[model samples]
Target: MKTFLLNSALLALTLSLSAVGGPTASPALAAEPTPAAPVAVPTVDVDPALWVVKDADTTIYLFGTVHILKPGMGWFDEAVKTAFDKSDRLVLEMVEPGAGEAQQLFAKYGLDQNGKTLSSKMTEDEKALFTKAMEKVGLPAAAFEPFDPWAAAVTMQVMGLQKGGYDVSSGVETQLTAAAKATKKPILGVETMESQLAIFDTLSQETQVKFLVEASKVVDDMNSSMDAMVALWAKPDPDGLARVMNEGLTDPKLYSALLTNRNANWAAWINEQMKKPGTTFMAVGAGHLSGTTSVPKLLTAYGIDAERVAY
Candidate 1:
């Protein structure tokens, strides 16, 4: 369940929450601000051969994906499709078509057993900060009281991104899912919706407060962050990826709970999948594929190597 919320929140922040905007409109909306051209970060060099792992007769192409995208931003390079075409199945963190189930699960886990609002669970300072952030995103202060702070932060970020012109319809996952359907390839989910939500359920109230406060500070820069994510994703640099992720590590507990721990678990599942007999295309957030504790590195711990396919 941690995987789901983390993935969803990441998607919400990086991609956009407007899942119904469709592909055509998203690029246009994402283009509205006309972001300054990104300053080039030094590219990390990795072995291209190591990026493609092959066993006996089966192959698994690990494509790090960005959940949100901008107009004319070309993320799906030719090599990506070549890798996809070779795969017999498509695998993702969650296979559900839309965010509806995620929304419901968030509402459920956000509520207290005693029927009290989650805002009641926060410190006075935390509540004040949360309220200000909610207002900035145009949400009523009371609307988020029932849920945990982390959940509220994620929701606020999603809403803020939408206002900033990021839309989920422009996401790589959504595009891949559509393409998979068009090609008649089978799509499988690594985890269930309930399990995904369960991760959020385990967070302590204190961790949740920290998450909300930190998220609030960066709400305005979400669009820039999205652009930065797209730029870094294009480079596929593991070290660069780690540096981007580290920027969000203000809350140590939430950082591990939301990113590191979940990456370990996803890496385990990915390792198991690699042992199977058919080619599979695994599309997950680019952030999950980098870092010392990333899925690719974790796979190495289990003796299953994930090679990054060049674009």
Candidate 2:
């Protein structure tokens, strides 16, 4: 359940929320911005895991990323940068929508116009838990009344991240997308933003409410888990990352919808890309590139092997 954002690609929504406005998009995160870190911090060289799939002419680099981070993470230097610089094209999980479009999409799918308020979906105990967490973040009990459960859940997580000083502008995708645009590199998406939103929109109400309840339990301090996840990623230990991110992701149906199915789709996409002749750097959430149902493992079933790129 916790892996939904880590593995299911809902992390993109956090960035989308920021793009539409700022963290203040949710009243929970309406605090003054923290001062930027000093410019002369020591660089901590991190070798995040990278892999490659190559044939005679085509080379595809598969790099895993933490969606958001505190600024000053010196991860873009080493082999990760070299692979990105050498690539002719950049492929991301989805090409994010612009601010106006994202705002419209959220209104269309994230709002609960036809249903009772998100709090109504909760049991008395559940509502108590969620309301308590909301109060902790200085949000009124009805602050999330207009949102669907999925939206409420995502907003809680995003607001927590903002409060913890995780900058969306420092996110790996944001950085890479800007660089790709600057160099005139053709940026592509394996899926569309609409399709990604549809995944959450199509979820069963039970699952949506369940996800919301889980999110509320730790809403005020969401970064503790992420800090641990980033530490593992900075160590370049994909196996360790899998252990942390994939933990408690046990529901079979949600598991398939979140991880295995998307990985299979990405493998098929890569197989088709192999038919062409160009270097492509594919960056996605680290959770997707780790775990037993990782993209590389699925690629193997398609007879394409992804080897680790030694730094």
TM-score of each: 0.80, 0.90
When summed lDDT is taken over every stretch of 10 residues in candidate 2, the lowest stretch is: 23-32
Q: What lDDT tens digits, residue by residue, belong to model 2 across residues 80-142?
A: 889999999999988876666766776667777585787778899999998887666555667
Candidate 1 per-residue C-alpha lDDT over 163-191 given as tens digits, one digit per residue, 9 for 90 to 100: 67555666677888888999999998776
Candidate 2, residue 145: CA error in Å?
0.8
Against the correct fold, how does model 1 do in TM-score?
A: 0.80
Q: Which is the leading candidate under lDDT?
A: 2
Candidate 1 worst ten-residue window by lDDT: 21-30
- Candidate 2, superposed: residue stretches over 4 Å from native: 1-41
Error of 2 at 242 (Å): 0.9
lDDT of the structure predicted as candidate 2: 0.76
